[model samples]
Target: MEIAEILDFTVPLSSITLERVVLAILVAIIGWIVVKVLTSTFTTALSRASNLPGLVVEFLARFFSVLLYVILALIVLAALGVDISSMVLGLSAVIGLILGFGLQDSINNLAAGVWLAAFRPIDKDEFVEVKGISGKVVSVGILATELLKPDNTYITIPNSLVWGNPVINSSRMETRRVEVKVGVAYDSDLDTAIRVATDLAAAHEKVLPSPKPAVVVTELGDSSVVLALRAWTKTSDVGGVQGDLNRGILRAFREAGIEIPFPQLDVHLTGAE
Candidate 1:
């Protein structure tokens, strides 16, 4: 009924009493407030970090949340007059054992995850060729990396593999060169063939102006003369430009009477028929 009476109360530390109950309630309230503040602070900080990957940010926020709550729980237990040092040591030992043997792959993945998040070699929705696999990145997760292939196939590669392999980001550059190689019959005018290719490349809307597409005589094959037509275009327009140029070259060559050569053989009966 009185403040003095509440303070003067006496009971075993292990046993619940009015004073202990009141202290425990206060401890719980304060711990809850601390948890809320810590969780919010950590989440806000992580969200504002521009360099961290999305998944890593989320993982770190959640990890800190779990870790903070665990700390608060230990504080609450201490307030209840329970010693937690031994418990902590024992828990640490168990975790160490688990990590040392049973969870090696998980640890490797976690390490790789950190590297992926930090370096950011590849990003979501970008086309990449890594470890002989080509696809658009879907998500880079803590344990695995996901990719969506051109055919709509989904691939899940472990983070360790993703990080270890060389990554080629096709979309990273603004422009890419598209090369079209064609061969003409030996009898066809090489100058005429080169003019047609260079003209088509220069006239294409998607091809870049500064590079100035070039037609080079690459080789003299047994059946035909090979010409290499190389042009630069925006990365996004590469496929379209390649297809259009192929079709256009075929039509142009036909109209110009420049024969696109095919292999043929003439055999004469000398000793046997």
Candidate 2:
């Protein structure tokens, strides 16, 4: 009779244990399925928006989904009367500490990059002068931005530096003014030089006539009078026009017999004197 009673009691307990085990397994499987479904739905929705790059959106979706699944797994384990909160809490603390110590610089730089990319102090494909280097921007990546220099060299500057410093964008304006100083000999005709310079500027294909070209005698130097010739050209043509103007002005001066005088130092030997 005693043995029979013990066997009956043990059998009910065994049945209860089996039931809990099955229930927990079913819950885990359901959780996995739900995670897969949720991630697929998220990706589809994000892709339909299409505002951002597809690869970037997909990466974010998958990352968040994995994180959510981790949390879900912990919750299911806790529901089964598992005291894993302490373990989870400890793990979170350790991860937080490691990130705080190891990735602080990266986080700061990343945040600055995001700010720059969003606000656009400088944009991709624009000409910007930063860190004393001027170039056309090629790529704006997370950590760095690449530029193609005027001389055809490639430059990569960190976003941290770009965001931290001032940037000068030349391409922002439709036109840019160029100022050139052409000096003539003190004895040469000042009015003629001014007229030649203005006419030379007018002849250039890139120079704009209005706000009409301006020429002024800025200063009288030791050997010559300096004429400041100001003209406007499309921002894209600055380099070629500048070179062409210098050559044209020189050629015109030579043909017109307008002497561009070099500085002459009148040195005398005092002791010999």
Candidate 3:
């Protein structure tokens, strides 16, 4: 049996000459290059000319690339003397069935992607927490959203899950509040402790002056007086400022002779039964 007979091609085996094979190879190469150039140009044009969100622009570029490649494939098949009309119809039917059943989750993800792109809840480079995962948004694609975690790991979440869950955007605000809780001995002077904490926060360069760093007595515990130090700083400086405050407060408390209390247990025993 000939090659054509195995694949049920309408074209006869004799027609599958070396020249046709070379032509097919040449067409594929050229088509691939053309597709690359077209997609690149289309992406650049959309980015420059339109106000669409970056994710939406990416989605459009991918869609256009897929469409062009499909067309290129059909042209290549035609060059091979294959009947394309029936093949296209058959492919359409198969695709329809796949979309209807096998790709339901994919369809939902795509829809969620569209919603995400349109609403602009999260954008590239923004720090966010969604579904208990915290990371910086890398790219939002048609099916999934990519995130770059703080520890240099990458995570990909399906758009459906991302859309269904609440998103916490930490980078949306210009500044963030940093709170550090400290406990002092019950016998320590509360006024002096508060003053030391307030001074420590105010001395930090990152801490905002307008809000004014404050130390408030939060709780009277079993072994200590709990005080909370609150300060505001630029969002990007939150971690650094918080660390500095913690270290500074510890050192300052020691120097000021204020005691940081720890939990203790007191027991009484009867001498006689």
The predicted structure with the larger TM-score, 2 or 3, is 3
Candidate 3 local lDDT, 92-169, one digit each (tens): 999999998899999999899889888888988899999999999999887899999999999999999999999999
Backbone clashes in model 2, listed as residue pairs: none
**RMSD in angstroms, all models?**
6.3, 9.5, 4.3
Model 1 lDDT per residue over 209-257, tens place: 9799999988988888999899999999999999999999999999999
Who wins the lDDT comparison?
A: 3
Q: After superposition, how far is residue 113 of candidate 3 from its true place, in Å?
A: 1.3
Any runs in candidate 2 off by more than 4 Å, and if so which? 1-104
Model 3 alpha-carbon drift over 4 Å, by segment: 1-20, 267-272
At residue 106, candidate 2 shows an lDDT of 65
- Give the per-residue Cα lDDT of candidate 3 at 224: 92
lDDT by residue for model 2 (24-104), tens? 678888888888898888888887877755434544565568687887788676645567968789888998998888976
How far residue 75's Cα lies from its native spot in candidate 2, in Å, is 16
